[model samples]
Target chain A: MDVFEAVAEPTRRHLISLLAERERTAGELVDSLPALTQPAVSRHLRILRETGLVEVRPDGQRRIYALKPDGLQRIDDWITPYRRFWRDHLAALEQHLENQ
Target chain B: MDVFEAVAEPTRRHLISLLAERERTAGELVDSLPALTQPAVSRHLRILRETGLVEVRPDGQRRIYALKPDGLQRIDDWITPYRRFWRDHLAALEQHLENQ
Candidate 1:
């Protein structure tokens, strides 16, 4: 699964939000969501890691996870064009024409 | 599945990108993707509609689809916080502290 799929799960999105604030230990991540078990959190973390949306580093016994912003550039690039949908109508039309 | 899920599939992302350029009829979308069967494109369009990522309306005999920018706002909002991850180190640290 890519970053888009990795974030499709709400739990992973929550994990991302948590990491956006600061790098969190794996244990802290598990504790943040009381509804999920440690294994469930691990599963989600694994997806994020695999997708490159999050990176992990050894911190002795603990593993630290932080937002890997580069992985998100694809999503950002995809959404950039759609942003014109909300821009001034005249400007949008001009950009549209320029692309043609 | 929400907008994130709607866009998770590459075909759907392609559809969104097509719509981002301009509104397109169902047939146009199907034709743009040569490999996928018409039904497959229809199914993807259905999911896009359900997720509010794409809005559809009948234009005479054709159904036109366009990106529903409002639906993407949630994703844009969620990613806003993470944007700081790429900013200058000092700025990121200051923003982190401000949020605390």
Candidate 2:
């Protein structure tokens, strides 16, 4: 699965968001997603792992999942050229608000 | 449709990437995606426009679609907290390389 396919699922995106802060064990990740079953979260993690968006390190009996920055580099590269659009708009909005 | 649902499709993401550079007419967008039929591209654009990821302006006989940065703010916000993880890792890698 590619980055596009990995992030296509909202649950996976949420998982990425959680991992963004720090690495967590599979059990910890499951605990965070209270509404989702362990099996469902495991499936999402599997897809994320396959897509390179996530990496896991085994520590004893548990696996710690962490966000792989390079996995997100594609998206960052895609958005780089467009950053000016939002920055400019934000500047304009700030100026307008200052005048008001 | 919500942003999650709107971006769940790969075609829409590709369209978003194309629009990131500059606004394009519906026909222009269609032309860019030679693999996809005009109807299919149109549907993808419709979903993008509905999700607020894109905004369209009518210009005489054409409609130009442009990126709506605010629509992406959610993802940006979600990524902010994690930026340090990559930055720190990159810095460490650079230090290690310099030592070598």
Candidate number achieving the greatest DockQ relative to the actual structure: 2
For residues B55-77, what per-residue lDDT tens digits would candidate 1 score against the true structure?
99999999999888677766777
lDDT of 1 by residue, A54-88 (tens): 89999999999988867776677777777666655
User: Residue B92's C-alpha lDDT in candidate 2?
Assistant: 91
* lDDT tens readout by residue for model 2, A1-100: 6776677687888898888867899999999999999999999999999888899999999999999877877666655676777788899999999999
DockQ of each: 0.40, 0.47
TM-score of each: 0.83, 0.82
Candidate 2 at B2: error in angstroms? Answer: 3.4
CAPRI quality level assigned to candidate 2 from its DockQ score: acceptable
After TM-score superposition, what is the CA distance of residue B73 in candidate 2 from its true location, in Å? 3.3
